[model samples]
Target: MTPPEAALDTRGTKPPAVLSCPQITTLRHRADFLRAARALRQGTQGMLVQARCRRDNDPTIRVGYTCSKKIGNAVTRNRAKRRLRSVAAEVLTEKARPGWDYVLVGRPGVTVNRDYTDLLGDLNYALRKLHAGQDQ
Candidate 1:
């Protein structure tokens, strides 16, 4: 008979020891968001993306999400932010450059209601535009 620990089927059950890509960080400071505000911006049907390259050599990407009160009451604003966060995580984790900060601003009518695929496309498109503008 096999030992208890050896009896378990662990073929595809083991978790990865390490992630392929570096993990992303969240921007929580007011100064960081303010600084990104002065950087390149691209607006899509769903949301606005603001990106700023940092001087440091950190390999982690930082992101922030915000929605104005004009979007609606507290519930509405939170929903918009939640959608933005999901889209950012999906799109920015692979595509966004390191040593940069990005902020996703929620639009009143478009953010919470837009299709998920369209939101992802918008974020990808916005990032491309922001980077292309930087190279010029």
Candidate 2:
């Protein structure tokens, strides 16, 4: 028996494959995340953070995503990660400072249900709040 071919060829898509932005990764290095948690400025809403900071040699801002087991099952966690990644792309591309890194930690409710535009707005608002906090 022959193997089935994919329904849609990969080439037809636009420049960015869903995962290529590279901003959304787990916060692997303990020190980096610690620095982000400590020295880095932060902002929050009903969700979690939309944070930013400058790092030497890191020319572009990167993002890390998280959702604890309490959030849901595997399918729900994956969906939340995807939504956060998409939002992080919009935040990094548009509002985020160039030399910063972001880490978006998901809250318990509505993370998957929130409107995309509103998610973007929350990210923007959070970044602005973080910056404002920096000034004072």
Candidate 3:
């Protein structure tokens, strides 16, 4: 087998192909999060998920994560947000639809302690529920 560096012919020649997942951007503005809040929502044991489909034809998935003060002090809230971010990175990269915005609200006591697999399932279930509601 060739060495790792040999795999990349980076001498002004064509670069080796890099395999990567599609890019997913974050929702930074308050207005974007508010817009999702006005759309469909589903709550689970660990989180509340809100999703909104945008009218524009952008083909990128946007996500936001929030943990209220009710969750705890700054440190605890930060920890919850971190966990929410990880879950989003794992679940949304594959499951989320493009041209949509999603907001994941962290639960006070459960978000930081819930099992990772359960959290993933909760997000999947919530998204399905939200979409199903829109069909009605």
Best by TM-score: 1
TM-score of the candidate numbered 2?
A: 0.68
Q: Rank the candidates by TM-score, best first.
A: 1, 3, 2
CA lDDT, every prediction? 0.89, 0.68, 0.88
**Candidate number that wins on lDDT, 1 or 2:** 1
Best prediction by lDDT: 1
Q: How well does each candidate superpose onto the true structure, as a TM-score?
A: 0.83, 0.68, 0.81
**Candidate 3 lDDT tens digits, 10-78:** 667876677555568999999999999999888999999999999688878899999999999999999
Candidate 3: Cα lDDT at 104? 98
Estimate, for each residue in 36-78, the C-alpha lDDT of model 2 and write its tens digit.
Answer: 6665444444357745465475546667777888778988888
- Superposed model 1: Cα runs more than 4 Å off: 1-18, 133-136
Error of 2 at 50 (Å): 5.4
Clashing pairs for model 2 are 23-63
Show model 2 residue runs off by greater than 4 Å: 1-28, 40-46, 50-52, 55-57, 133-136
- Kindly report the root-mean-square deviation of model 1 from the true structure over all alpha carbons: 5.8
Predict model 2's lDDT versus the native: 0.68
TM-score of structure candidate 3: 0.81
By descending lDDT, how would the candidates be arranged?
A: 1, 3, 2
